[model samples]
Target: MMKTTSIIASLLILSATTFAQSWTVDKVHSRLGYGVTHMGISESEGSFKDYTAKITSSKEDFSDAVVELTANVASINTENEQRDGHLKSPDFFDAAKYPTLTFKSTSFKKVGDKQYKVTGDLTLHGVTKPVTLDVVLNGTTTNPMSKKTVAGFKITGTIKRADFGVAAGMPTAMLGDEVAIRANTEFIKD
Candidate 1:
């Protein structure tokens, strides 16, 4: 009886795994970038150099999917070393204390033919807040060499730095409060 139960359990696990499609972020072909107004004159853009993302879904349309991601806070680069260092300090991201920023989706709702409203909890600088992103499915294709199915997406959102406890002493005239986020990512079926 014990052997029979174990065999049944194994089959159940295998069946569940077979039905859920898993996708891993193709980091080399993906980017999570951010832009903000600097000095009320120009926009400063940057991107995290290291990050990881995973997606699991049971629906072909991906409306029932779940997405999770983590970005290394220390990987921030803005084309200026001094400014990058400042962003890593306690006054900013506090990279030494909080080395990673993370997000986990609570819901993925289809809004249009290829558009979605993704609501998730974003944690940064020791703070967690609920935010919604406008996401567009850029379609999917199969790689010739690996023959793996690849999916593309464009996600856009905004978060106030002060709300995430990332506010420094910079005046409003010097820096904008809202950080505009834009990410273009490709995921490969695993």
Candidate 2:
């Protein structure tokens, strides 16, 4: 009886781990982006080129996925070298003080065949906030070069920049307080 019990327990544990698949971020194909109001009418867009994320999915399907990501605050770029320098100053992101931003998913639920809701805690500038992202699973495909099983996903959300100590010009209550955040990531089974 003892031997049978031990065998069953080991099998259960093995199945639990096998039922999930792990993936690493393909940084070359992934992008982190944000948009905010520039001067009341125009919008400013920027992308972070340096970031890393890990994900685990049940059966290698994104519908049952969990993910965590970390981004370097100093990697922010808006295509303008001058503005990029300003963003790293005290007037904006202040990358020198806080060098990293992180996100960890708490839950992932399927809303449709191609859509999902990912709820996570985002840490920025030392502040952490709970956020829910609308995600679209762009489907799975094989890479021509690597010939590996890859999944694509797009997630978008909004957060109050001021809450993370990014309030440079948000002195009054009239201007927008939230910034649109988005990310596109491709993951490969590891």
Give me the displacement of residue 157 in model 1, in angstroms: 1.0
lDDT (CA) per prediction: 0.92, 0.85
> How high is each candidate's TM-score?
0.90, 0.91
* lDDT of each residue in 124-160, candidate 2, tens digit only: 8878989888999898889999999898889898888
Scored by lDDT, the top model is 1
Clashing pairs in 1: none
Q: Model 1 over residues 1-190: C-alpha lDDT tens digits?
A: 9999999999998887788998999989998999989999999999999899999987778898899999999999998999999999987889999999999999999999989999999999999999999999999999998999999999999999888878567776888999999999999998
Report the CA-based lDDT of candidate 2 relative to the real structure: 0.85
Point to the candidate with the largest TM-score: 2
Candidate 2 least-lDDT 10 residues: 167-176
